[model samples]
Target: MAEPFHIGFLLFPNLTQLDFTGPLQVLARLPGAKLHLVAKTKGPVETDCGPFLLADTDFNDCPKLDMLCVPGGFGIDQAMQDADTIAFVKRQAEGARYVTSVCTGAFILGAAGLLKGKRATTHWAWHSHLARVGAEPVKARVVRDGNLFTGGGVTAGIDFALTITAEIAGESVARAIQLGIEYDPAPPFDSGAPDRAQPETLEICERRYAGRVADFEAALAAALG
Candidate 1:
């Protein structure tokens, strides 16, 4: 029998749950897929939103994956500075068919030197930092540059998953999965982007995120070091 397509999502403390779960809802349905939730150690990892998730495998035990996914959230600052995590990503990406990330997770990939000269995207708040890590940032929901795929913000992971599914299993398979999940989105809000959001709304968001920017900048420098 053919080998199951082994896929792993790197798990860490304080990551955005939707960044990983949204994509998992789609990719888990791919034909022949075997999913692994990986971490530096085997145990529960907390999400930014307060839930704890178990890491099914640790770095030493994780087999070389067919696909490697990293999710981003408030904990991204710490992840970027984590030597073991960066080394694991670099090692897996060396053999994986695809190297992908969601939201600020691309920052982790960039830290591993996978985004050099590659076009990528991340949460709009952190898009400017991509260049600091040597990636050419594109402001898109999903940016695909060769085997590197990146999703912007939190919910874009769903869109990224379908795109990756199509790339791996063919469009028909992706379409079937989409229909199965009723993936059609008709969001009631039009203020998702900076260009569309009211000035006051943007200011409020900027204020909320202002305090974390310095921490991120420091982490990026450490990661790139």
Candidate 2:
């Protein structure tokens, strides 16, 4: 009998719910996929939005995954600095057919030493920091280098998942999923990217990230040490 295609998303406290759910919604439809929401424990994990996601499998019980995704959120500041979490990601990457992350989740992959010497990307706000983890940062919705894949920002996780799905199953399958989910994207604003955002909008975003960036840098330093 063919082994089920195991797919996992690493869950941690305070992850942006969309980062995890957006991708899961797409990947869950993959042919014969067996999905797992893995975390440190079976207890519920609190997302940044105040909602909680229950883990079906703990790190210790997770089966070897064919594909693994780590989603980003403020929780990354904590997860990147976590030794057990880093070790778990590292160990899983050794056997995963594809190792991937979304947004700042790239930092966790980097902390696991998975992004070193790889070309990758993350949320634009944190794109430059990819270099700190020894990665050549690329700006794109999805960047794939060898078996490592990464998505940009939060909503990009869905795009990233579709890309991987196409690779694994086929373009036809991916197209069907996209149509099924109506993955058409038409945002009300053209200011999603820094290049497109107005000067004032960019300034506001910068101000908002000022403190968060500092905290992220400190966590990155400690994790990479």
Candidate 3:
């Protein structure tokens, strides 16, 4: 029998639930996979939008993971400056087969010093921020540099997990999982990307996220220095 794959996903306050849950759904189906929802402590963690998820284990209790996954959201702004959280990620990533993140989670990985010189991607708004941590930011839904895998924005976690699934299991297994999930995505609109969105729509989003961008940049500067 194949060895059980121990996979840990970092959970924290204000995370975008989809970033974690989307990947969790795919990875949980992997053959011989054990999933761990880890946090600084074992308890309920709230999302930016008010959903609560219970953490399965505290960092101290988690076994060395085969893969360490981080999912990002507004809370990531604070996580980047958190020594304990960053230390946990660094410690797990040191021995993990894959160090991965979704969306702004890349910033947390950067703060851990894991992204140095690696090709990575994050939310479109934070593409320029990757350079602050010495990472080469690639514009794509998913970017893989060796064992470091990063997914862009909120909805990209599904794609990222399938990519990891294919790498660890096989394309056949990945395809089967994708089929099970009915992963065919047909969006109602073509405004998912900045380039495809109308000028007014982009402007509104940019304006709404400007403060968040500033906050993240400040946190990254502190974490990197």
Candidate 4:
């Protein structure tokens, strides 16, 4: 039998659940693919909403993956600051055939210095932060630079994964998966991106995440030292 294509996803406390799970659900359905939920340590990791998820494998035990996925959330601030986590991402990305991130997970990739001088995108709220991390931020739902794929916000993970499937498996497989999921997204709200959102709404989101920004800034400073 052919070797399975292994995909590793990083799990950290306070991570945005959709950022990883949405993509995982799609990718797991692919034939002959192995998925590994990797964490710095073995055990349960909590989401931002207080749900705990059990990881399938610890980082140390996992082999080099065909793809490495980093999901973004409030927890990413902590992960970015963690030397161990950053080092793990850096090492895995170096060997993985594909390196990818969802939403603020791009920040974690940036923290690992994988995005320097690269064109990328992240949650609209963090576009400036992406620039701060030495990446050229693009205004798009998904940005692909070489083998690195990045998506914007939580829901964008689905799009990124579908795109990856199209690239790796085939367009027919990606279309089948899309049709299986019935993924015809029609957001009730008009504001998904900053440019589409009202200035006031954008301000509110910025203010709401101000503390996280500060925390991430400090963490980046320490990590860069």
Evaluate all candidate structures by whole-model CA lDDT and list the values in order. 0.94, 0.95, 0.94, 0.89
What is the lDDT ranking, best to worst? 2, 3, 1, 4
Clash pairs of candidate 2?
A: none
Pairs with steric clashes in candidate 4: 72-105
Per-residue lDDT over 73-98 for candidate 1, one digit per residue giving the tens place of the 0 to 100 score: 98988998898998999999999999
Q: Which residue segments of model 2 deviate by more than 4 Å?
A: none
**lDDT for position 108 in model 3:** 93
lDDT of 3 at 128: 84
TM-score of each: 0.98, 0.98, 0.98, 0.95
* Deviation from native of the Cα of residue 29 in model 1, angstroms: 0.2
In model 1, the Cα lDDT at residue 114 comes to: 91
lDDT of 4 by residue, 14-121 (tens): 999999899998899777889999998888999998889888788789788999999999887678888888888988998888999999999899988899999999
Candidate 1 structure, TM-score to reference: 0.98
**Which pairs clash inside model 3?**
none
lDDT of 3 by residue, 1-225 (tens): 777899999999999999999999999999999999999999999998897999999989999999999999999878888899989998999899999999999999999989999999999988888988889989999999999999999999999999999999999999999999999999999999999999999999999999999887777788777
Candidate 4 global lDDT:
0.89
